[model samples]
Target chain A: MLEIKNLHVKLEEEDKVILKGVNLTVETGKVHAIMGPNGSGKSTLSYVLSGRDGYEVTDGSALLEGEELLEMEPEERAAAGLFLAFQYPVEIPGVGNMTFLRTALNAQRKARGQDELSAGEFLKVVREKAKTLKIDADMLKRPVNVGFSGGEKKRNEILQMAMLEPKMCILDETDSGLDVDAMRLVADGVNALRDAGRSFLVITHYQRLLDHIKPDVVHIMADGRIIQTGGPELALEVEQNGYADILKAHGLTEAV
Target chain B: MGAAVQKSTLEARLEGLSTTGFAPAARKDALARLVAMGLPGRRDEYWRWTNPADFIAATPVPAQAFDDSDEAPVFEATDRVKLVFVDGVFDADASDDLALAGVEITRLAEAPDLNWASGLYGTLEVAGQTPVARPLAALNTAAATDGLLIRATAKAEKPINLIYIHRSEVSDPILHHVIRLEEGAELTILENGPAGARFNKVMEVDVAKGARFHHVRVQGRDHERRAATAIFARVAEEALFKSFTLTVNGVLTRNECVIDMVGDDAVAHVAGAALGDGASDAFLHDDTVFVTHGAERGESRQVFKKVLKHGAVGTFQGKILVKPGAQKTDGYQISQSLLLDDDSQFLAKPELEIYADDVKCSHGSTTGAIDETALFYLRSRGVPMEEARGLLVLSFLADAIDEIEDEGLRDDIVGRLEAWLNRHRD
Candidate 1:
């Protein structure tokens, strides 16, 4: 469902290159886990795919369901079923959480030429989804993540993923600030959406998240490129021996 | 700076204007003060940020009335005692019956007996004249043609809403109002509409011991209109006074609020939200506020927010003064502006003076643009760029809008703000 062909990216304001000749592809209905050390350009790939600013694509292209995502605006990418779960959710002080979600849903619907959902209808559906994710009614009524805790924010992201029902989801360090219980709750939410029609790109440093939302394929990314590809066992190898051994086997000498 | 030239300046401005004598003593005193102070100019320290030329011009500059037919009249369906004014004249036929329980309403145009209003009409205006002068308010008191004199003796069942309508292209209207609440009485006043081509208004409120007074106003009319308005209020012991104004799309607007907390444990809050867009050099908004704490344990808060674009200019001058004996006073002031582009500008001056050492007071001012990270987050959620920016702008004004006591009135104001943002979306 998602494909990347030799995506080369660099910081727009700086001369440093981040993703140097990176290529990857995730088939339909599959979960791909990318394991990398710090500053290995894993997050840059997700940002470039989601059409975030501050990054210039020097060469190559990213396609989502055969549509070029690099040429589309962020909202258009979202309407075309590309979702990026941010590492840091924004805090909007005055916009209510429910209103923000409803606006997003209706906007995507309008962009897709679908009828908008009424307030009442939207409320019923949101309440049901929020219940399974353990988000309380007060959290939904408050301003969008203004005073939410880490766990609540991550869960809120999962709730958006579920509501949007995107074709391909990219989890960019979603487990960074979450506790173990929060991680389990978030993984359960992601696991619930696993099916034959949706694909996910799980980016992480540890294999703990993969143990919950088991991936079908695992790839080791080093120096802005995938140097090793294997099954789920590869995640265990990286967790057990660290990237030092992987880098050594790949004829590279870099400590992580 | 000769006395004769000052007199001529005042005379030229007040030419061809006559009104029914409401409070002869107060009006005479106000005229004397206006003559002494003359009119504000760009050289004045208080008027440096915003020139008073439009307000001081001899003849009202003509303005083509803004077409607001697409918007529903604010507070039209609310349950309240409605009073309508056209070009500063009271429209008895267009207004509801001037009778309500627990309150007394007197029209200034009828030359009615001032009764309790005789001493309280311009008392606050005169008292607030020290240290700084507000000559425009003095002019309004001296030349205003008509307004309402309302006194609430008990808790009122409904709000008192005054709606102003503009129909003349060259109407120059000056209106002065007096509001008094007796001990333990409660009242809320709502004012909206574009009054005239050039509008000058002043409201003086007397909140008695333990009384509560709330005022919410919307200064909107034709986009080309120019207005200068002032509110002078005195809060007694244990009394509460709150006033908020929302300004949208005027060539020039200056709203000044002066409040005095005279008794212990009194609370006062003055806040405003202004949105301006200037295609030329016509849009400028200024808010000048002064709050004084004179008693023990008094509390005062001033919150003002502005959103400017298209080279529109906004200015804020606010001060909080705590007297020598006003120990345990708590005062807070904040002024913030969101400039949508490089062309827009915001100027703010926040001051705090504490004669008492045992008081807590803080003031802050900020000018910034939209948060780009937040913008990207919203866009990633599939919200269009314009709608996302509009949402953020409304959020920036939430602090000022929250000062309103009524939820319905708050919703009405939000609806109008949203409409303004949608129309100005670029």
Candidate 2:
């Protein structure tokens, strides 16, 4: 469902390559977790996939559903069923959350030749989904992400992913700043949306979130590239022994 | 003198006081004081943004009798007590007497020279007298036409509404209205501008100790009309003064408001929203001074928001002043504007002058286009671009309009604002 081939990205100003010759592939009906330390280009990969501005894809292409995703604009990528749950969602004042969500959902629907939902029907669906996620009604009426707690904002991102129901979902540090309860709630929301013919690329620094949403494949990333990939047991190994073992196995560790 | 000089003098006598009821000696004294101050010009600091001299150069035509045969007001709140004035004369048939116990609604000409009017007239200065206002205000004082003077006595409970309506097509007609609220009095006034006429009007408000004065000025006029109105308010000890000025239409309109917090613990809230299109020019200037002399705490806030499109021009200037001994003073002024089209322009200046070391004063001014993310968010929801823009613009102005305590008046102004947006959306 999603493929990244030698995805090389560089900062616009310094031209310093961040993602160097990184490759990854995920089939439909599967979940892949990308575990990386800070500055490992995990967030860059998500941004490149979603077509955010300012990241120069120096060399490489990202394909979603066999379509060239890198060539599409942000909205177009969104319409084409590619979703990136931002690490830090932008706060938009004077724009209600419900209004934004409905617009995005209807926009994707319209792009796919589907009828738009009326306000009443849209409200009904949103309210039911919100109830399941434990999102209060007042939160929906507030400005998008304005004055929301960190966990609440992350939950809102998950809510958008649920509403859009994209074919491919990329979660970037979705567990950061979340309490134990919030982390469980976020994991539960993602789990409920899981199904065959849908894919997820969960990016994180720790293996805690991996416990809730089990992944079929776990990849250890360091120095802007994926150094190793193994079965789900790799995550438990990294949690217990840290990345030292992986770095030593790759023969990249400096001499003491 | 000579025969020709005698003829000229006879002609001057024939003119018989350009207007009526003006005491020559008093008018002369006021005119002398005005002449000394001189007409406010572009060089004047307060009049820097606005070229009062240039505006007065055109010399708007003098006040003339208006034809009252036109249709009634395009919109009027049914619950509001209405007062209509044609030209500079109050229309008795268009006004209803308020038999409310604590309220006194009468014409300025009918009342005795009260101490408040004597003290307020020509005493408030906004960046020195501009050439335009110097001559115009001097002329207004010289002519001294009839004006509405509404008073709410001390401890008055009910809110008194004073509707100053301008019904005319005259060019340079000037109208003056004064309001006084005694200690512990409460008053709410709704002042409406001319529908399709040119005017230069001034209103002076004196709020006494512990009084509460709420004013909402609604300006929804034709685009061809030109107007410049000023509202000067003096708030006494522990007094509360709140004003919301809404401008939806006009060719060239400016509403200048100055609130002087003379006593401590006085609070003032001055908010304005100007939405214009099609060569319309709307400017709102709020100059507030919070003086915390005896009372330790005083608060003043000013917020002005404007939406401009289709070559429209919007300006917001807010200044807050805190005196030397006025410690613990809280003053905040924010001016924001949104320009919808390339041709539209906005100018905002938020000024803060504080002498007291312990005072908290801040001012902010920002001009920008609508939030693209918000816009796309709305459009993606199937709302057309224009509708989305209108909704955002309305939301932007909602902050200022929400300051209005009167729900009906707020709705009326909002409705007119929406209509203006709908008519001007391209």
Which docking category, incorrect, acceptable, medium or high, applies to candidate 2? incorrect
TM-scores vs. true structure, each candidate: 0.97, 0.76
Q: Model 1, which residues run further than 4 Å from truth?
A: A251-256, B1-7
Q: State the lDDT of candidate 1 residue by residue for A99-175, as single tens digits.
A: 99999999999999999999999999999999999999999999899899998998999999998899899998889
Report fnat in order of the candidates. 0.78, 0.12
Candidate 2 per-residue lDDT over residues B1-426, each given as its tens digit: 556544332223214335445344445655566556655566865566555532354344332333333324423654555667655567778676555568766666665463346554545433223222444455455545666667788544444444444444443456667788898988887776562245667677888899999988766644444666777778888999899887765656767676778888899898888877765344332222222223347888887888877777776666676767878988887888888879877776666667788988777888889877656544433345676677788778767887888777677777777676766777
Comparing only chain B with the true structure, the TM-scores of all models are 0.96, 0.83
Candidate lDDT scores, in order, read: 0.91, 0.71
Q: List the residue pairs that clash in candidate 2.
A: A103-B381, B39-B130, B39-B131, B40-B129, B40-B130, B40-B131
- The stretch of ten residues in a row with the least summed lDDT in candidate 1 chain A is A247-256
Q: For each candidate, how many residue pairs have backbone atoms clashing (under 3 Å)?
A: 0, 6
DockQ for all models, in order? 0.86, 0.16
Candidate with best DockQ: 1
